[model samples]
Target: MSEEEEVELLLTELFDWYGYDFTNYSRASLKRRIIRLCSLDKFTSYVELRYRIRTDTDYLKRFVEEITVNVTEMFRDPLFYRTLRTDVIKNLAAKPFIRIWHAGCSTGEEVYSMAILLQEANLLQKSLLYATDLNPSVLEKARKGLFPLSQMKQYSENYIASGGAQDFSKYYTAHYGQAKFDTMLAEKMIFSMHNLVSDRSFNEFDLILCRNVLIYFDKNLQERVLKLFDDSVGPLGYLALGAKETLKFSSIQSKFKQLNKEKIWQKIR
Candidate 1:
């Protein structure tokens, strides 16, 4: 069979056997990731890779992690967070209760960052941050709120650039090369597994952040996911995307007004 055919078969098996639907993902991206996984695992043939993935549950977890985009950090784009601080959070502050969904929240860094922003605005007490990812392992890590201490310096700089005035070190305590964030920051967070490809909207949100994730999806999947977001967000709610993602020509374009300087949009209809 051709490599492309093999891949199609594998995606079908994954959905049928594991209930993970990746058929609509970008073919180029999936091929590259599968190739890399094969090389990294030293598979003698695609058959070997396929067999291991089909029979071994442990290996399947690793396979899913490898295929999905999970790289994330706190305040990834300082200017984006700055805009959230200056524009989005301020508008949300007036609501008696705020619901923010972090779709594909990898490892919870950005969710913690949002918690800090709300805390600074005195809105944390009234806000609920729903953080979801397809990978359960990452969600478990996110629940702990621990990250490498070495990353704090960069995150601290990002915090300052994003208009933060307090000592960033105060947010976490470092021990043995690991930084454990304050439990308070995690108290308002709800971490769970959600697959955007097949999951339906669960709650109406005031703000939805799905940064840098749509790039891995094909146009059709992106449109479907965007519509799911449209249904999930209340009128006047904000939708945040990654730097490269946009709603310009999507099905929901007319309903959202894009912020001029950032990849954020507010629902108008």
Candidate 2:
């Protein structure tokens, strides 16, 4: 079979054997990642890769980790966080309770960043942050709230640019090569596994952040996920996407209005 045909067969086997679906992912991106995984694992042929995935449960976990996008950091796009602090958080503060969902929250840096934002605004006490990802391994990392100590300098700069005035180092303690974030920031967080391709909305949220994730999905899947977000967002709630992603021309475009130049869209209808 051709490489493309092999990919189709592999995706089918993964769904049938493991219940993880990548069939609806963006074809180009999925293929590239799959090919890269194959190369990184030194698979000489498609059959070897398929056999390993089919027979080895441990390898399956690695496969899932490799397939999903996990490139994330604290306070990504500082200006976006600034907008969230200035515009979105202020609106949410009016409510008695705030429910924020971080969909596709890979490793939880952004979630912690958000918790810090809420705490700074004195809203963390009344808020719950639900963070979900398809891969459980990343969730486990997120649960630990430990990040590489080497990255602290950049994250501190990001925290400052996001309008934070306090000492960012105060948020975590450094030991060995990792920085363990304060447990207080994690008290309000709920981490779980969720598949956007096949899962329904579980709760209505005041704000839903699914940054940089939809770009990996096909147009049909993108629309489906957008509708899911629309259904999950309360009236006047906000939906945030990545710098490259947008709701324009999607199934839920008419229901949301973009806030300035950022990718955050507020539900208007």
Candidate 3:
């Protein structure tokens, strides 16, 4: 059999064994990540890689990390956060409390960004942020709240551009080439495992941010996920997508009104 076919067979076996449904993921991306995993594990061939992944629990743990999305940074796309501050926050101020759902929050950078924004607006204490992802490994790292000190410089600039008024240094302490964020910022957050594809709506939220994730899904899966988000959001709540994603052609497009040309939408009903 061809190497590509062998890799596909291994992936199919993996899904059947672990119940991790990655069959619908983009093929090119999946193949690239799997090949990288094989190299990292020092496997000479896909057949050997499959054997190791099936027999070694540690190898399976690493496999999960390889398959999951872990790319994120604080205040990513400064304009989006700026828009939230200027538009969404202003409208939410009158509410006594707020609940935000950060779906597919890879490693909690966006979650922390939202916490900082709400804190600055004097709403952190009254808000609950639910940050969920399918991968438990990244969730653990996110819970720690420690990031490389080198990243802080750029992240600080992002904060300023996103309408931050205080010194970003106040939010974290530097130690041994790492910066650990304040625990108080994450105090009101509940980090947990949630799979958008298979999980049901558990709570109604004021704002649901599921950015950069749907791009990996097919149109049918995208529509299904959008409907789930719509059902999970409270009436007139905001739903934010990635810059390249939109609700325009989805089945539920008519149910929401575009808040901005940058992929922000709101449930009108």
Window of ten residues with lowest summed lDDT in model 2 = 247-256
Each candidate: what lDDT? 0.95, 0.96, 0.88
Q: Top model by lDDT, which number?
A: 2
lDDT of 3 by residue, 1-269 (tens): 88678867976897789766676677778788888887887888887888888899887878888887688899999999999998897788888889999999888999999999999999999999999998888899889888999999999999999889899999999989999999999898899989887789999999999999988877777888999998899988999999889988788889888876667887887
Q: Compared to the true structure, candidate 2 yields what TM-score?
A: 0.99
lDDT of 2 by residue, 1-269 (tens): 99899999999999999789899999999989988998999999889999999999989989999999999999999999999999999999989999999999999999999999999999999999999999999999999999999999999999999999999999999888999999999999999999999999999999999999999999999999999999999999999999999998887899999998999999999
Per-structure clash totals for the candidates = 0, 0, 0
> How many Å off is the CA of 165 in candidate 1?
0.3
Q: Once model 2 is optimally superposed onto the true structure by TM-score, how far is the C-alpha of residue 166 displaced, in angstroms?
A: 0.5
Q: Any residue pairs clashing in model 2, and if so which?
A: none
Give the TM-score (vs. native) of candidate 1: 0.99
Give me candidate 3's TM-score against the actual structure. Answer: 0.95
